[model samples]
Target: MRERPPAAELDAVDRRIVDALQGGFPVCERPYAAAAESLGIAEEELLARLQSLLDRKVLTRFGPMFQIERMGGAFVLAALAVPEADWARVNDAVNAFPEVAHNYRRESDLNTPFNMWFVLATETREGIAEAVRKIEAATGLVVHPFPKLKEYFVEMKLAVRGEALS
Candidate 1:
């Protein structure tokens, strides 16, 4: 993850785009057109601006988040305790799995064996087990699965400083 904020250079329009796009994206044949219409901008301009934002690293990811469980799929949070010497290899091995949604490196004050964490999304519940087994085999480390016991709904949105959503 980038340590620096890309917030310094965003203009009002870019800020609006970032704020507006956090939720309620259109689902239509011409979604961009619809979105651009709502933003009061040309579709082509919206495309160009979005591309520019990505190119400038202002947005690391811009995509839809599927409700895998609702779709009869499963999402499992998994972790691995990887040695410092094998970080690269293990990271590559874990990320190579098609089921991996995203991976992160973390640390704790306690002597925890797990430092590498990731989320796995699979079409079937059994697929989570298969993915964990495959990752363990590939990385020579145990993949700990932590399935969620409860779901919490949190809606997060932010506006640029000195600006408010109208």
Candidate 2:
């Protein structure tokens, strides 16, 4: 059994900062500074706290979630089946491609159906297809590429609210 980490209490100020940064960071060049002003804290302090939270796993990820359609970037939704013996090695090889945003391990018949799944972002359909091909060749396994026909909605926000929003 895995041991759980100790719970850390968050003060009002910390909650405020976390809530402010939950949705997305400001798109401007000085995002931290903007977030600092909105949270009523010094820019440096905001950076420090954010770093601490990241180190502590309070924030799993903190960055931009690009609008691929608006940016003319192709989003390839894909999955792969790997033998249990090859799961870890194949997962690492597939994720080595920089275009891969993130991947997840899912339970499958081969021991896991989508033992590996990820999104590849590129400027063209052909590019994404090529990436899938390269990943398959590199991993010595079949990769099922499923390019998204449309994006109905992407719900990513998860804020622990109660603090004021600026």
Best by lDDT: 1
lDDT of each: 0.86, 0.77
lDDT for model 1 comes to: 0.86
Candidate RMSDs in Å, in order, are: 3.5, 4.6
Estimate, for each residue in 40-143, the C-alpha lDDT of model 1 and write its tens digit. 99999889989998998877677897788988889999889999999899999999999999898888879688999999999988889999999999999988
| Deviation (Å) of 3 in candidate 1 | 6.6
Q: List candidate 2 segments past 4 Å from native.
A: 1-11, 23-33, 60-63, 108-112, 161-166
Q: Which stretches of candidate 1 lie over 4 Å from their true place?
A: 1-8, 61-63, 158-166
User: Against the hidden true structure, what lDDT does model 2 obtain?
Assistant: 0.77
Error of 2 at 143 (Å): 1.0
How many steric overlaps are in each model, in order?
A: 0, 3
Clashes of 1: 0
Candidate 2, residue 100: Cα displacement in angstroms equals: 1.4
